[model samples]
Target chain A: MGKRLEGDGRGGVEQDLLRHDCSIGEILKQRGVSRRDFLRFCSAMTAAMALPASFAPRVAQALDQVKRPTLVWLEMQSCTGDTEALLRSANPTVAEIVLEILSVDYHETIMAAAGHQAEGALDKAIADFKGNYICVIEGSISTKDGGIYGTTGGKTHLERARQVCGGALATIAVGTCAAYGGIAAASPNPTGAVGVMEAVPGTTVINLPGCPVNADNLTATIVHYLVFGKIPALDSHGRPLFAYGKRIHDNCERRPHFDAGQYVEQWGDDGHRKGFCLYKMGCKGPATFHNCPSQRYNEKTSWPIAAGHPCAGCSEPHFWDTMSPMYKRLPNVPGFGIEQTADKIGLGLVVGAGAAFAVHGALNALRRDKEPNEDTREG
Target chain B: MSNQPKFKRYIWELPVRWCHWVNMACIVILSVSGFFIGNPVSFGSSASDFTMGWIRFIHFTAAYLFAVSVMSRVIWSFIGNKYSSWREFFPLMTDAGRKKTVRMLRYYLLIDKEVPETVGHNPLATAAYVVLFGIYSVMILTGFALYAQHAPQGSMHKALGFMYVLFSDQGMRLAHHISMWFIFGFVINHIYSAWLMDIKEHGGEISSMFSGYKFTVKKEE
Candidate 1:
């Protein structure tokens, strides 16, 4: 099926661009992106993918030969934070180049079409690229009351998600909302929001799940697909294993402080000023998984923990429910209310047991003292 | 009935007793260190304190000891006497055993005054032991699964990677954390039950765990 997108060998760079059927490399060349810059991006992507340095050239070669794939981006029940983060990618110029090569046929938030025109564009894109376009969902699907909670273009978000994901080559859930319902599905989820995969079963959905997913990860995922003609290797959560494989704590800049038993006891404390570990400040880095450390946001400028804040484990599944309160360890034990921690519950049980033991022991001692020969009786 | 005097009978073997105490120590260390590892308490300000690191090291060490002791105990269950045998731990396998378990439960509830005498663990205790072992198996399985995430990709990964199918890392962590509490409750109940039985039976049940022998009145089979 991918062969249909291949270009004819008899074409010059200009001809390839005119036909809109050239490899990414030819398109880059046409766009005046030098070969060196393209290769440098490929090398960077290779490193991000955790491939050996020796594979950089191979990555460049693969990327240079791939056709511009069609993409349809759908916005659902979300704040559009992922789109904002994507715009703020480390290399916006490179991001634009990559987005151009992908030929995003229809994107609701960024497209110029309005009302019926936009709906027509979506229908046309789905028809033209049927079974070939990549479906990028940026938000969760609201399935409550037949998806009345979120509607766009006269169709509910759940209906649109199922429709778009149905005929796409691959479905990419681009943020925590689209991946695992994020804040939209947190406790008291009256809207009944669900992730893309849950909204559309029987399809492989690649989850790039950050609160606002790291642009580098989204770029790498698309690049991996463009280069390899398949989804990148995913973890159990359907996230790219290379990006989410290691714990954030393992690579945090303040790891030395963690190992040294130094921590910021309170906000803006001396330890905090000195960049001690944020473990005491309710950092979820120990449990979170992401490449935010090495692949810092905003062009490697800084991330949450790097900026003297603790990680909220935004990249993990169920962050809203599991990693909340932002300043505490352990999820609140259910049925015990928010004030009770696992430690508190456990200690309470231990204490209760001790109390019961004392009372039971005292009762047993009194019984034994009353009847010294009672123990000698047998049936 | 003209009764015979009580006599001491060898029951628990030396290896079984060793496994019990070592496993107990390991569990205590594992629980304390595991809690610390889960929720680290900041100690010093030096960048090279290594307190959490040492805590983790100790936790891992204790975890290994706990797993090994349990493994060795399982192996010994087969070779040990009837009292220490694997079958004794699974009293539900026999109808008679099931009946005794009910009777033991009734005795504990004060519905029955006369308790059925058993040389080793009462059927109720045996069933509880069986469940405890099941919990141990789950803890070990999940513990190794998490450990294997960091292990090199050869034999260790090949052996434990399949565990990924059972639980997500977060789910596994939850299970591991919850299992620790189950064990903690079991230890409390176990000690209390042993003391209660020792007093009621006057057979030195608690002391037998250490001495490998129980002083019981000789009765006709």
Candidate 2:
């Protein structure tokens, strides 16, 4: 599969898909993915895909029959944490089930080769998969310093991104950095960093923005593309609508506490022990937009806020800059800035006093300003 | 005086009267629209965009009108009659009125068996109106502050963002909600006192607001 596409990886990309779909029965039988396990995964993928339970069989047929789409996985300026987390996928490890079960033409981290051999393999993989393959980009693109700050195989990250996007069916920016420019693009962004969609103009990029987005989101996105030939519904940020549509505050388990005005007033207070709202403590969940509290991390084990810490809102764009204090409310509204409740109490007293004084003045004015015979009777 | 009819006209010029009633209508419209905007309901399906945009537009328009109307009333306060002008509130400006105010309050509470024929705005009555205006002024500022949120880069936006940053959008949101209660409280006291004044002191006190006539004692002792 590697040497045959020697020059054009597009052919190799097609063949990879062909083999994944054509030999799945034989291969699953051989690899022991098991017919029942494969069907279960299909139904689960369908559910994840947001289709009815009845679509499970169709999903099974599609999963078992769809050719493995060619995928080009690139790492730019990142910790490569997405790849590391990908290894933790609970179901069949999409990396293994799809990435391996198919003829993955190019994947830097998992590939056996390195240096000239690996570089040569990447080129072959691209040419073989052109126009039909999927491009999964991890890490942000550094546009600063002539994109020299981050490079892959002598090509700037931005350049490689453009090159791969030109002949791709879909581009998936796999983590916060690659999706929404993550922390790298936070205020005073030193790197002039950008997400894949920003780096490659006009390319339809789907973002999976979390420090490490839930792996199922990644696999589900792929399965969606494979089965439907189109990306799923997305929100304003081009993240899947199902995942990024609601405020973490809205869906948080702590929300009842918030609505009830019960809050964790101090770090070690009894309220904190009782798992009250973190809003007063500067939780940015109310302002942030994400599905963290809903989908959760590590298969619903626990999310950051659930662990009794305020949400850092890592998935939101420039969150570190905009939603700081991470737990406090947005700074005072503009004109209302100089005073809070103090203004209320202070002004109330002032006006209340002033009203008292004016009432007295009115009485004097009533006498002095009155006509000569008007008020003598009252006196 | 004519034998058949001679109408009394002591205070409240036509424009002042006009501004007062107009201010009332505009406030009602603003409060109604503003309330809906504050708690918008996107009646559309889950996929549809929110629909409170029209409600907000109406609210903002009403706020702008309310501001103009309020400014007109403030100018009127300065130049209108003894009953309606700044003089009306002048009694609240000194400490000497403490006993008078208590007496006036007692009169208002129906504590005294005999009612005073308060010809002009009474001490307590004048004070309450001033407080109402003060509350309205703060509500106006808050109204503008809330308006500014939708256009953070526009003038209103910058203004609103300024307040949101200063107090926090949540605080502003809260101020906006809580002030409604103050208005409600003011209304409760205002109507009750007005009704009481009409009942005890003068049968035509409130009607004088519309008819611009108040009857003084025919012949004081």
Candidate 3:
């Protein structure tokens, strides 16, 4: 790895100091964090990554000796919810410490620099860590109208993404917006926002798509990268397999209830109070892929389904269109009226066919009876 | 009509009739079970009841049978008699087939008082079967895609996960669900047409599916 420090001073000597030379272990030691706590964090990450417990030591060793890599966080057309989720991670102290060890050279939200200085820092970081830094994109890149929909520092998100993500070692699209355009690219998308992979084509983008991505998944991804020196295995959608290999329905706590056909029909019902399955209430868990059931949100407290609200399939692509009406089991058939569902349209066609056939049969009977002497010849 | 000698012609083979009834039974079971899977009937107040599980089991079992029947029928289309040949499905490929199809269309539209008879399926019915097969293909693919979710990391998951690239999970379910109605529509028309032809043509059209033979006038050589 290139360890050269470009000491062009926009900041002090402290900012110029080469922190990449320091291993994660040394930094954690300096921060008064116990070795046991560090190992526990590593084991937690290993477990989160669905690795065998025997691999904990390997993960711990790799993370301990690994040098801090440069990370550049790009916030485009987003709500900054991913960043908030990361800050409120399950193991906040350990996660924050691990994040701190990584040289996050450019982040718009949390960076101390402003205006031109911030822009300069971003450019400098990209230049210094070209082909090495991990670029984490948080929001969708608006591509319509020459990308005038979203611009920062006189540069369109598309332009900035192409430049920054094009050179990174690997790009992690952190939220649904950056992964699959989320709500911003919902129906009637005026901005024409697209995911980071679509915006910066051919770049190795590992998507961690959630409404606000689970901080644990992001943390596990970073740990996996640090430990393995490469990104984890990804699904077809480019999501890490460990975090998104199974449907939420498969691992859900209320799965037993679903199999037992005990569903909460409505809000505040007897079944709801008894912790029945939310399948009837239009839970999208069957369609959604996420570890939210196992790895709960907001510091492992409670996820949407666990809290009696059905999953809105926030992790899925085009979920705003495909996974709605959020309160219904199936999406309404497109090209049909908004209220007309697939079942309604299907039932109508079946009934119409039945009725038409009935009428035709009736007509054939009447014609045959009226013309009893009609020739039954094969022409 | 009284002087004509009626010849018993073998139109449907044993395998053809077997696959037809098998396919029919599977479609009916799959449709009913599949519909229930999509919109489960909430029953049994106790959590011990395995209603959805039983429903899903029936759906999956019917799905496998449907798959096998479809596959075998497709295979038979290659090796079976010319009547059940794969070429028969593509009726628009031949000039006579096109003419027959037009005649059948005219008869259905009441523009023509009579339609030319054939040994095997009429060109119009063959065309409809082709579309139904297309719907069957969509249903099977979408059904397998949905089933793949149950076995993540299994071979089925690996083989069928590409469906997500074509459609979202719920979209796949919708395709499978809507195709059920297409089958229902086809069944309605198919039954009525068969019944009508049996009555008007003096051929055992509906019974031919059961006996694999139809009564036709002998063409004197």
User: Tens digit of lDDT per residue, candidate 3, span A1-379?
Assistant: 1111112233332453376789988877866778888888888788889999999999989978998888889999999999888865666566656565677787787776678888888888888879998999999999999999999999999999999999999999999999999889998899999999898899999999998999888888988999998899988889999999989999999998898888898899989999999998999999999999988887678999999999999998889989999999888888897889887898899899888888877766655221112243332
True contacts kept of each: 0.35, 0.01, 0.60
Best model per lDDT = 3
lDDT of 2 by residue, A1-379 (tens): 3321222244233444456455444555555566776776676566555578898887666666666666778888888889877766554433355444345567777665566776766676677767777888999999998888788888999889988887887889988899867788877888999899888989878888888877767877887876777888885568886676667877889876654546676798977888876766878776556777866776556788899998877776656555554545533323445334433543465556556555644543343121213352231
What lDDT score is found at residue A59 in candidate 1? 83
TM-score-wise, the better of 1 and 2 is 1
In terms of docking quality, how is candidate 3 classified?
Answer: acceptable
Once superposed on the true structure, which residue ranges of model 3 sit more than 4 Å away at CA? A1-16, A368-379, B1-5, B219-221
Residues B34-132 of candidate 1: C-alpha lDDT, one tens digit per residue: 887677778765797899888878988888888899999999989888888888887778996777787778667655656455678777887888899
| Model 1 segments more than 4 A misplaced | A1-19, A368-379, B1-4, B90-117, B149-175, B178-182, B199-202, B219-221
Q: For each model, chain A TM-score?
A: 0.90, 0.79, 0.93
Please give the TM-score of chain B in predicted model 3. Answer: 0.94
- By TM-score, highest first, what's the ranking? 3, 1, 2
Q: TM-score winner among the candidates?
A: 3
Interface RMSD of each: 5.0, 12.0, 4.0
Each prediction's TM-score versus the true structure: 0.87, 0.59, 0.93
Candidate 1 has which clashing residue pairs, if any? A90-A299
The TM-score, computed over Cα atoms with residue i paired to residue i, of candidate 2 is: 0.59
